[model samples]
Target: MAKQGYHHGNLRQALVEAALGLIEAQGPQGFTLSEAAKSAGVTPAAVYRHFAGRDDLIAECALQGFRIFGDLMNHAWNDGRPSALLAFEATGRAYLAFARRFPGHYMAMFESGLSPSVTPDLAAAAARAQGVLTRAAAALCDHLPEGRRPPASMISAHVWAMSHGVVELFARGAPGARGPYPPEDLLEAGIGIYLRGLGLIPADTAPDPSAGTAPDTAPADPAA
Candidate 1:
């Protein structure tokens, strides 16, 4: 049992908020209960008055991370971007931006061990975030052939997977040689690639390859 201090005013909220800051600064593995308590200006035992232990606290922190993620998506959707592809791209950029801004929370959102099971709050947050993407995908689907709607779900999944993979790779850095590609360029190319796959735009819509000197020609690969 956690030893409680005589005055635990808003200790629970303070502890959670402090843990969020710590997680955003240090990765999940970096924080300790004693450290959190110290940061909260309370006794180590006081932490347990709110969270069960390190795992419980980590879980709550991660849940909060997902909530933040959902908020990011909601904000992007509310921006009233016109193109479905543009809206989708904005959301992708938002995700990567959040990850860059809060590396700890980003990791915690995906880290299973810290909060392996999705609590009700986390689940709702995740669903809302996904719903944003699903609606965008549905909009894209409207432009697609009837036969393609069923596959939009898979395409949506792939879009998220691609964004997540690309961001994670960029965060980790390359093994050797100088990192040539910029993050924004990589993300734009990734979104373009997925958009092409969804048929929302032509694959040949990529930047003019000939530095404005050449006439527009059909894509080399007609299958695209």
Candidate 2:
């Protein structure tokens, strides 16, 4: 039990942190509301003051997770500088990095079973993050003929799916599971092939080959 007279001015944040810890230890469905309260060092009733119920708390955690995830992706994108292709590769690496660095938040954001209809904040945050990929795809498609260019939405979805698949397969830290290459390399190779298929990158125009290894010397701009 928490000590008597404990005063948490930011009990809401405390509860959310505790909930993330619990989610990490046990899957999203593993813990109870009361257990969360106990872990937060607050009374069960105090939790109700911030969240309507277990679902509400879980939703908030997922929402926060998406916000942080979005920010990380945005930073990784760096506004498509130096070159769109290189920036896109950085964004894919960022996705895998986030999954590895914040396993708890990653699981809560992607595996919580909370739909956007039920959590609009989560939906919005996810869209912002995905927008980075959409924009990168748009930049890539710019090189293709207008008639041949794939829809930005399609490109975004394909790249997002590919990145997520590689991260889950190679970066999730599964016991005894190993891949032939690093997650970033796998993602880069897959994106290269996908871009080729879309005709976004011309086959005759020899690929940079070292595009993914290019240094990020673009100007600093958080908005980008």
Candidate 3:
């Protein structure tokens, strides 16, 4: 069905939204720029006015994803208030929450084949998102012995890997999955264990619930 009352002023935004919906239903490679234009209620040629090609549109989507992900993590971090460890854990929760709430954006940000080098905008956006994780990791290292503290980059990668693994394996909804634990609980437990193993926190320290609850899922903001 052709979109009714579509205006040129809204065409760009419409195309982006359409692309996201397509990316959600199919992987990044599953749709084309022409299809996005059709979904947006515009002619295929209209897409070129807003995006150079499919890769450009995908990069824009990924850039927007990173910006949203960064904001969520930064809000959760809250400048490491109360305690650094607690704030760091909150960031982890935010990561999982973002993944669950915006699976398409999440996939575009990480699983899309586009490399950061493809676009400066995408690279910068990705860096900002990763910077949030790096800052949290640095905060977590405060309790470690000076000599034992790992590089923030290493810590960030380790935590990110763990969170990503858990999200992909258990949280994304597998068939017949009958687990009593929620994804947040599993994430907190895994992060706690990993921190303890790194000696960043004492072996007996329990995870703190007072740090911050995961942010409620918000409507996707594609403006970025």
Candidate 4:
């Protein structure tokens, strides 16, 4: 359907941008279609023409946030560093950076509880985002011992839980958050620990000098 003013162009984009601000300032509960339309200088009815309702808009917003987040992870892993574990670490750093930079979007993507009601477009966007992470997990799986590859769903869930635990806790005011550590070292230790438990890391080889002891993943600095 058509929207007011030829110049404003897409009302959907405008509504998404406006909703982001609302999410940032007032959080998901405070995000509303009427408020978004007001912020975008469009009628709420105009927003409805693009979205079925507030839930629909929130679902799209969540999916967009995931797309942005997935891109960050893809970029981090794009370097193709020899160590799949290293690439995983880079992805983690990128993920944390996104959460810190775009807390509103971060919250919307994970905490808003919007995915369940997403339309096909939003659902596809979300799946694409997850596919990026799933690919990375698959890479890490290669280094594991035979018969050790985690089930696809389990691996994706665990890695996401690990990454999100750090970001969400810090975002929600964890008292122990710390600044970003050397990505390789932190991830090496984490991957090492997890892998070692599953017998993935080669035990006979002396630890690489570059390998770092896990610097407390526990959030230490509130300002991270």
Clashes of each: 0, 0, 0, 7
The residue ranges of model 2 lying beyond 4 angstroms of the native Cα positions read: 1-7, 174-177, 203-224
Candidate 3 displacement at residue 164 in angstroms? 1.2
> Which candidate comes out best when scored by TM-score?
3
- TM-score order of candidates, best first? 3, 2, 1, 4
TM-score for each candidate, following the candidate numbering: 0.78, 0.83, 0.85, 0.74
**For residues 106-180, could you state the per-residue lDDT of candidate 4 as single tens digits?**
777777777634577767777776777777777766655658677655666676777676655443443234535
Q: Is candidate 2 or candidate 3 better by lDDT?
A: 3
Q: Give Cα distance to truth, residue 129, candidate 3, Å.
A: 1.0
Off by over 4 Å in 3: 1-3, 173-180, 205-224
Lowest lDDT block of 10, candidate 1? 171-180
For residues 1-224, write the lDDT of model 1, one tens digit per residue: 23245354778767776776777667677789888888777889878778888777777766777778878986876543665666767787887777777666677677536443446776777677777777766666676568766465676687778778767677454321234676666777877776676566676745556686555664332122
lDDT of 3 by residue, 1-224 (tens): 34556775977777777888888888888998878888888889888988999988888888888889989999998888757887888898899889878877887777778897788888988898889889888877766578888899998998899989878877775421535677788888898788778777666533457856644443221111
After superposing candidate 1 on the true structure, give the runs of residues whose Cα lies further than 4 Å from its correct spot. Answer: 1-8, 24-26, 112-116, 171-178, 205-224
**Cα lDDT over the full model 3:** 0.80
C-alpha lDDT values of all predictions: 0.68, 0.78, 0.80, 0.67
Give the Cα-based TM-score of candidate 4 against the true structure.
0.74
Q: How high is the lDDT of residue 35 in model 4?
A: 86
